[model samples]
Every structure is written in C-alpha cells, then in structure tokens.
Target: AMAGLTTIRGLVPAIPHAPVAARMPSEITSREVLFVKSLDALQRRSQLSLRGSNLAAFAGRRTEDERSRLKRVRNKEDRKQAFKDFRAVATVVSALFAGLAVYLKYSDSELLYDFDITDDAVSIIAGLLFAISFQYSSPLQLLLVFFGKFETERPADWVAARIAGVDDPKAMTEYNAPAYAQVLSTALIGALGLVTASSLSKLGDTWSLSTAVGTAFLSFLYEVGRPKRLSSEEVVAREEQWSDFRQFAEARLVKAGSCHESEIFDAFVAAFPQYRDDTEGKAAFKQLRRFVYQWNPTAERTPYGFYKNVALSSTFEKGKTSALDS
Candidate 1:
C-alpha cells in the first residue's frame, strides 16, 4: 500500500485493462477504481482533509510540530529524572561506603584483612564523607533553622499580587548571610564533623587531611562556578519604603478625588524627596497602581487607564450642580 507510484493495472494484471469493471451488470458500466499512488499521496490526502476541518491551524491538529515539541519536552523531563535518580543513588552508596569503612577501622573484622582494606583507604573514605557533609550543609541549614532568611520566602504583597492576577512575582526576599559566609559556615561544620568522627575511627591524620582538602576543593569548585543571585537587605528596606509610599499615594488620591499616574508620582515625590531622583518612576508607578487596584475603596479606574475621583471629577461636579439647581 505504501509502495511507489503504480496504477491498478500494474498492481494487479489479472484485472481487465478496459478502464471498467468486468463484473458489473450489462445495463450499468463500472467506473475505473481511483486509488492513491503512494504513501506521499496518501499523506497529502489526509492533510487536505484535516486542513478542511474547522480552525485546523488554530486547533493545532494538522502539524507534526506540536507532537515533536511534546516529545522533546518529555525527553528532557526523562533526562532530568535520570540525573535525580543517579544523584540519590550516589548519595546512598557513598553513605554506606563511608559507614562500612568506619566500621572496619573500629572492629577487628576478618573481612577487612581479607579485602586488604588499609588505614589509608579508610581515611580517604572518611574524608570523602566529610566532603559530602559540606556539599549538603546549605540545604541542611533549611532543616535546622526553619526561618533562616535565605531569600527563598515569598513576600506577602508578591503572593497577593499573583492571586489577583496582577503579576507573576519571583521570590525576592533579603538574605541574612552572604554567599561566602554561607560557604564558610558549610566548611566549618563539615570540618567539625570530620574532627568528631576522627575520635571514633582514629583515622590517620596525614592521609585523611590530604583527601579531605582535595575532595573539599573539588566540591567547592562546583559551588563557586554557580552564579550568585544574592537578594540584599535593601530589598526589604525598599519594600518598607514602598509601603509608606502606598499610604501617601492613597491619601493624596483620596484627597484629590481623582488622579493619573503622573499626578500621583509628582505628589509623592513632593512628599518623599527620595523617590524624586528615580528617572523612570517605576517604584512610584507601582505604588500608585497598588492604591488604585487594592487600597482605595471609592477609586474607579477610567477608560484611559487613570482613576476617576468618584467625589471630585467633572462628572461628579456636574451632578452636584444639577442637584443644587433642582
């Protein structure tokens, strides 16, 4: 059926070549059987039919591109899962290996003698365990201190804004510690663990220290290569300042009975000179929007994207005048 272009006659020579069905009745003549010549022709027919469907292009059913894209996404997800699985397995295996080495050092096991497990090998394994401790310390901080300021917490306003469909905000809280400080802490704690374990296993200091330093260097190299995205204390300070600005803007908007973004920014800058130097006025604009969207009860957004002061705009004034006249 998928063979290259060929006529019915060529496909089946036993059929009559008279371009009519020989098995048809004498009164009615049989029409020549029409068939697709090849797989490409069949594909063209299927595509044509699909294209003729309602909104086929918009519905995205005609193209293989979407399917190909989905397959690529699935492949990437599979690769990611594989890496995670491998990491988990490596972690478990390393822990078990370190435990066995430590046990062999303490116990006069015949298996240690049989396997020729030397003191240097046990020291290296212990060092590797220390390196693993350092590798895991940053995340371990999360486990130890639940409220450690790591910039991973969602701000109240950010979450509210997302729920209101205003914006998709990133977690941008201030970190209490710098990257180097955190890294130093990890090293200190890992070293402490190594020293503590040395008491139990009585590891050879020379071999253990060398392996520990080498493994620690390599592990920390990966950490150093990662891009630092430190959220500053200034972010929290600025957000606090924005809260004050929101109050100021809301008061001004309510007092004026109506205003646009520029008017609000001008008034805000007059009150708080710190925002005056902001050339883009992005912060001021965000505050004003917050006031209009969430803060003010009587504030109504105008068609032109400004607010109409329900109490002070021209429409309100005219209505007041008409009521007085009546």
Candidate 2:
C-alpha cells in the first residue's frame, strides 16, 4: 500500500502541507490539466451536469444542437424516442462486432506469432468504437433485453388492421398501441443490427451482404413454416353471415300460430343450440325459407310452411299438392 501510494505521489506533485478542510477536489485534479495535455471533452461531459463555465455551456449547447440535426419529423417526442432507440441499437451492434474483431485479429496474427501496424490499428479502432458506443451502457442494454419481448408478445393482426387505417377505439387501446410499441422496438433493433453489420464490415462486400441476406433468409424460413389460421377476409365474411343468422333466428323469428318458415328454423336452433351457429343450421334455415315463398312472386302475402312438404320446394304451383293440405 505504501509503495502504491508513493507511485501515485510521484505522479501528482507534492501538495504543500495544508489544512484538510482547505484542499478541494478540483485543486488536486486540475493542476496538471492546466499544462494542456489532451483531455477528452465528451468523456468529461458525460460526468458533468449542465452547470458553470464556457466549456460546460458549450457542451450543453452542442448536445442540444446535435439533437436538432436529425431528420425533420412532425412529432418531437417520436423523434426523440427514435434517436434513443437507434443509438441503443448501435451500441449493441458495435460491441458485438468489436468483440468478434478482437478474436479474429488476434487469431490471424497468432499464425505467425507476430502483430503488424495494420492489425494494431484495426484492433485499436475497434476497441475505441466499442468504448464510445457503450459509453452510456444502460439504455442499450435494456433495449437488447426488451428485443425478444417486442418480437414475441406483440399482437400482429390487430396491429396490421390499425396500420391499414382501422380506427376502432377498443382495438386501438387493447391491441394497436401495445403491439405497435413492440413492433417499433423490434424494428429499431433490426435497423441497428443491419447498419452495424454492414457499415463496420464494409457494405456490398461478402460479409455485409451475406449477413443481411442470411438474416432475411432465416426470417423467411421461420415464417414459411409457421402455422397460420383463417384469413381476415374469410373471417369477416363468415362472421357477417353468422351475425345475420343469429339476429334473424333469435329476434325476428317467433313460434306463433302461423307456423312460419322463420319460426321453424328458430325452433331447430332452440332445440340444438350447439349447432345454432354451424353450417348445418344455416342450410336448414335456407331450406325452410323456400317453403315460406309463394308460387306467385308478385304476391304481398306468402304461404307459410307449417309442416314438411316436398312440393313447397318447387316455385311452379300448377298442380303441386302439399302434405299440409291433407
């Protein structure tokens, strides 16, 4: 401990014996700094708050100006969120490539048991970029952790409908917003991943192009085998028929003395509620409708089918006999 203390004491000039209360933290660190050794402004700015001096004010102003230089967007909050998300994404991507570059560079140099200027420069650049990228580590780390949540938990169909201009209030709250947030998060991660892989490795070269293409191909493969259910169009059509049938059978139809076709269909559904919404029930209803139509299309009042009669199936009534007539 004494040796380490002496080593540090040698680097720092002797602080003349002074009262403990009299020594300030800045006085200790700033003495050597006045000699003009290159100090990193951004590195210090990260620790300093918005206060004091021209340098601090300059840093604050530059930060604000840097924020405004992004693409013009209608929503200020949205643009701000986008910047945070992408920066996080970039940090993760840079770390990944930097780590890989370290191993690759070290391994390649090991074959001859020597290092060259090119290898050293590449490794240094990668290390520096990784450090800068991860300067504010927490946000990007959280972004990585949440990536899976967005990809898996978001409701896809409702989000799709919202994107296509469906403005349903309930859907917006229950499905659209949550799902949209997830999708946006996932997109930011993807954008960062692609940009990092391509830019760092060199665009249009085998590594970048192959990385992009492979990611897309794997995504395609995953989707192609995924189990898909009924389409939105088919669901809409089926529900329309189901709704109309439900209203007609339960509300409009009644078992009155007239024994109308609608009444008979309603009776069937009432007896078999399990099949009430099934295709079989719909077929039976359509069959009963034929019995309710009169032979003359111009007539205001049509005869009702009180009982089963095959003759009622025909529109022609020249000499058709009904079992109900007996």
lDDT of each: 0.48, 0.42
| Residue range 1-326, candidate 1, lDDT tens digits | 32333444355534544555556654443222333234346766766776765454554453456557856876676567446633643454355456656776677867664432335555546545553544433334334345643333222223333444444344433322334443343344444444533543554446555555554554444334433332444357457666866676545444334445565566667777766433224545665666556555566666665565423234344554222223
Best by lDDT: 1
Backbone clashes (count) for model 1 = 1
For candidate 2, what is the lDDT? 0.42
Question: In model 1, what is the error at residue 142, expressed in angstroms?
Answer: 19
- Work out the TM-score per prediction: 0.28, 0.21
- Residue pairs in steric clash, candidate 2? none
- List ranges where model 1 is wrong by over 4 Å: 1-174, 177-230, 255-258, 290-304, 308-326
